[model samples]
Target: MKFALSLLVGAAAAQCGKRSPSYLTWTADSFIEHGVEKNFHYTQATLYLGYEAAYELTGDEKYAEWYRNQIDDAVVLEDGTIKDWDYEFYSLDDYRIGNNFLWWYERTGEEKYRKAADIIREQINRHPRNQAGGFWHRRPVYPNQMWLDGIFMADTFYAKWTKMFDNDNTTAWDDILKQFVLIDSHTRNHTTGLLAHGYDESKTAVWADPVTVNRDSGSAPLVWDRAVGWYFIALLEAIQLFPESHEGHSILVGFYKDLAAALKKAQHKSGGWWLIMSEPYPGMEGNYIESSASAMFTYGWLKGIKLGLISKGEYYKAAKKGYKLLTNRFVRADDECLLNWEGTVEVGSLCCNGTYEYYISIPLQTNDYKGVGPFMLASYEWETY
Candidate 1:
């Protein structure tokens, strides 16, 4: 979908544009996840996988160009030992991006891709660690806090980097394994079979659980859609990097299966997942379906099947149902050619406390990157499906 970066409205329309076309355009800002203006940093990492996938699928140079732009952002000097990117700015939260860059470098042998990947290695070289040596989510701020989001962002990058710059760098694997240990130790909900949004080691945030040592970062226990979506992608991405012989390999595979089983129970009767997972009561307020989260799940499940990570029989059926629902429910056409995409960030939201009212209140919009990118990737994954 073409990202709408601009819009036109008459004086009367501008006053009542809520009744008119309210659109979002392509931007360099990273906060366009749900078509919202957020204070998050836009890392080329998130776009990297989508761009590479797009390039290979469309055979278009523009996708390659987009990949190049991300490289440009990270490339620093003659030797990529130092990069222009500030480690203090954001941690490896976007590290999966490096795998894309490295893949591009391997494809073209462009020194910059290699050099840029090397620069990222340096960031890992100096990354701060927790007491168990788990890398902090970001440097210079939020020390010792491990966000579930960071695992996919960093581990996928590090694993591929290990194969590249220096296969001899066993420390990379150690770091990767330790990160899983830290997050699973802190965030796993044994009974519910889902992960919390993020974990704070210092217990500084008001959200941090004082007793169990976890954090209450995700607003709704209903499984914040995009947050878990980020995680699901991360899990598959990490699996690609591991050896079947690795100790965590089986454990991680089982983890994926168990999570999917739980998620299956939470899916909406209409084929999507409820805004507040684990509880979608009829005639309820917040217990409803969401777009982005559902799409992300669909994409991940399909990819998992392709990777041989799940039983194709039942899981494939669930995935197919989700695909039909997403395309039918979330997608809308535009004749004006001005706007062409839409996605609901989630069906519900929660704050103050998790409730039905909280789950269904999340705003929905079109062409949200969180939904669009994944949708494009998922569509490309199963064109025949």
Candidate 2:
């Protein structure tokens, strides 16, 4: 039955002028064939998210089966506790893979997965927050800071958990909405209508403005494309799980629309976005099209359209173009048939000054999990859309 559905979807995709070779499957297969890291990192969770999407799109059990085994092996222990789970560090990035825990619980009625999820939820409940009530991106190391990346890492899982376990808790719903509102208030770029990479609420970080926490004062010198990409997807994820009757539903939807419009305007002519996404500055000469963020934005736009948050007439062409450019420019095949994604900044963080040079100077990597995960996700969204 799954085979028949695949064939039918394949034919429809071909009729729609989709790439005949199934980039989605090839990419997933390549990642699997090459082996993946066994860690509780957000990058691995992102690829898992992409696999879940592929399973949904193609009705392929292999995707789900592989994901379940990976989670069992790398994350959950036989005792139902997270393997090597650290309660002291309290990193939001670590909470992301817990989404898979909820996935397994929903499908198999397993206490082990739900037990692991409860541990993560407990950590999040106690996770440190800045003065304005944003989850500090991480504790101790990135003290009193909230990076846009943290939104996608932790909040998506929080929203899903709230929906599944505590839907009637108005406090949880309001807190979820407050996180988005707080970060947007701190980091929004008025000129570009985009948010900066992060904000330091205590104003102690080197990049933070001592007096005012706006980008102009060096709180976040420039907008990083991938950071906004994270924020964009996080908004959509929250909106999907928020009930329509919830007072925060329309507020999150409004935020999603505003960010979508801003990102649409920021799309480059090459159908990708630059490492430095904001206006041209004195040192912004060498900004080039980036892959991970492009893939993420493409996924966000396509998914937003799928959810009916935005009109297809206005955004479909942009998303379609972004997907085409992603394949053409970044997705590469080696002689071994393994896929490699190029042009992803190795790391972008508020640990530095958040300057244009800091972002552009970051090293590029091939098959970096960050790029591969999002590219896989974008391909699946494009195929299914």
Give the whole-model CA lDDT for all candidates, comma-separated: 0.59, 0.81
Runs with alpha carbons beyond 4 Å of true place in candidate 1: 1-44, 65-84, 94-96, 139-141, 210-222, 278-284, 336-339, 344-365
In angstroms, give how far residue 127 of model 2 lies from its true place: 1.1
User: Which candidate leads the pack in TM-score?
Assistant: 2
Cα lDDT of model 2 by residue, 147-247, tens digit: 88998999989999999989999999889888888888778866668887887777778878643346443356578888888898889889989988997
In order of appearance, the predictions have TM-scores of 0.76, 0.91
In candidate 2, stretches whose alpha carbon ends up further than 4 angstroms from where it belongs are: 1-19, 210-218, 281-283
How displaced is residue 163 in candidate 1, in Å? 2.1
For lDDT, the strongest prediction is 2
lDDT of 1 at 295: 76
- Model 1 scores a C-alpha lDDT of 0.59
lDDT of each residue in 258-316, candidate 1, tens digit only: 77776776676667765445433533643446666787788888888888888788788
